[model samples]
Target chain A: EDQVTQSPEALRLQEGESSSLNCSYTVSGLRGLFWYRQDPGKGPEFLFTLYSAGEEKEKERLKATLTKKESFLHITAPKPEDSATYLCAVSNNAGNMLTFGGGTRLMVKP
Target chain B: DAGITQSPRHKVTETGTPVTLRCHQTENHRYMYWYRQDPGHGLRLIHYSYGVKDTDKGEVSDGYSVSRSKTEDFLLTLESATSSQTSVYFCAIREGQGYGPLHFGNGTRLTVT
Candidate 1:
């Protein structure tokens, strides 16, 4: 079974502070790793997809990087509106289903 | 944003009643998935469909059932609602196979009292 684990279940950061969220996984053969941001009472919003080790993607103030066994989502100078839960998921080469992590809730205060 | 839509944004029902959640997509996506989100569970897939009438169970599929009768509609039904089944259900769609990112609906909040 493919499994994913996220670190620091919850985080509180002040405005303009930067931080990173971690996602560790074990799979038979990783096909893709995904990052998503979900606000309260809302479904997850797609952020980026990292296909292999050394691959990275960026959008707005968020950057995602992948390694052989884990992925990291780096938030640069986060603002108050950046507060949300970040989720990580992996799809194995079998292409069956995505295994998701418990997620890391971020709270950015102004 | 994806064209996915989940009906009955918020529903409150008593235990033992049957509840059905509907997911509709405007764009013809080949993959449709049903996931439930809780406080600490994140998003767990309950079921998914590859095409019309082609469905597969996910990691957590014990209490839920899904059906895809058409290209754009997927239905998830609970035989008998239980308090444990209360969660925010999200419907997601993907245009292609592997590596394609999923687009999700806003989600439906179900409460089984």
Candidate 2:
């Protein structure tokens, strides 16, 4: 069975604080991994997609890195607006859809 | 987001009643999906459509049915609403294939009494 697990169910951070969320997975054949940001009362927004290990993508203060067994979402100098539930998902040979993690709730207090 | 819209942003219905949720997309994406978000469970897929009139069940498809009569419209129907069915449902779309990131709508909150 393919599964995704995210760590640090919830995190509180101060402005300019940096942290990294983890997403570890086990799949038959790894196709891709994705990251999303969902705010309260809204659906998730697409953030990044990592297809292979040692790959990394960044947008503004958010950066996503991937490996054979896990993925990381690093927040650098986060702001209040960056506070939201970050989701990690994986798509592998088992299915054509994404298998999502429980997600990490981040709170950046300004 | 991504030119996708879900109708009935909020709904409250009684048990055993039939309820339907609609999803509209203007991105012309070939792939559309319905998922429910709940505490501790994250997001669980209910169903998805690959194209017009082409739909399939997802991980959690029991008691749920979907239809895509048009390229831009997908409908999810709960044959008989139950208390366990109350949840925030999200609709998503993907423009390409393989590794295309899905774009989601604001979501619809459905409450079953």
Q: What are the per-residue Cα lDDT tens digits for candidate 1 across A1-110?
A: 89999998999999999999999999989999999999987889989989999999999999999999999999999999999999999998877677899999999999
Model 1 C-alpha lDDT per residue in residues B18-55, reported as the tens digit of each score? 99999999999999999998887788999999999999
Quantify all predictions' global Cα lDDT against the true fold.
0.92, 0.93
Model 1 alpha-carbon drift over 4 Å, by segment = none
Per-prediction TM-score: 0.97, 0.97
Give the worst 10-residue stretch by lDDT in candidate 1 chain A.
A91-100
Q: Which residue pairs come into collision in candidate 2?
A: none
Cα error of candidate 2 at position A50, Å: 0.2
Over 4 Å off, model 2: none
**Per-residue error (Å), model 2, residue A27:** 1.6
Q: What's the residue-level lDDT of B58 in candidate 1?
A: 92
For model 1 the local lDDT of residue B46 reads: 96
Please report the candidate that would top DockQ against the real structure: 1
List per-candidate RMSD values in Å: 1.0, 1.0
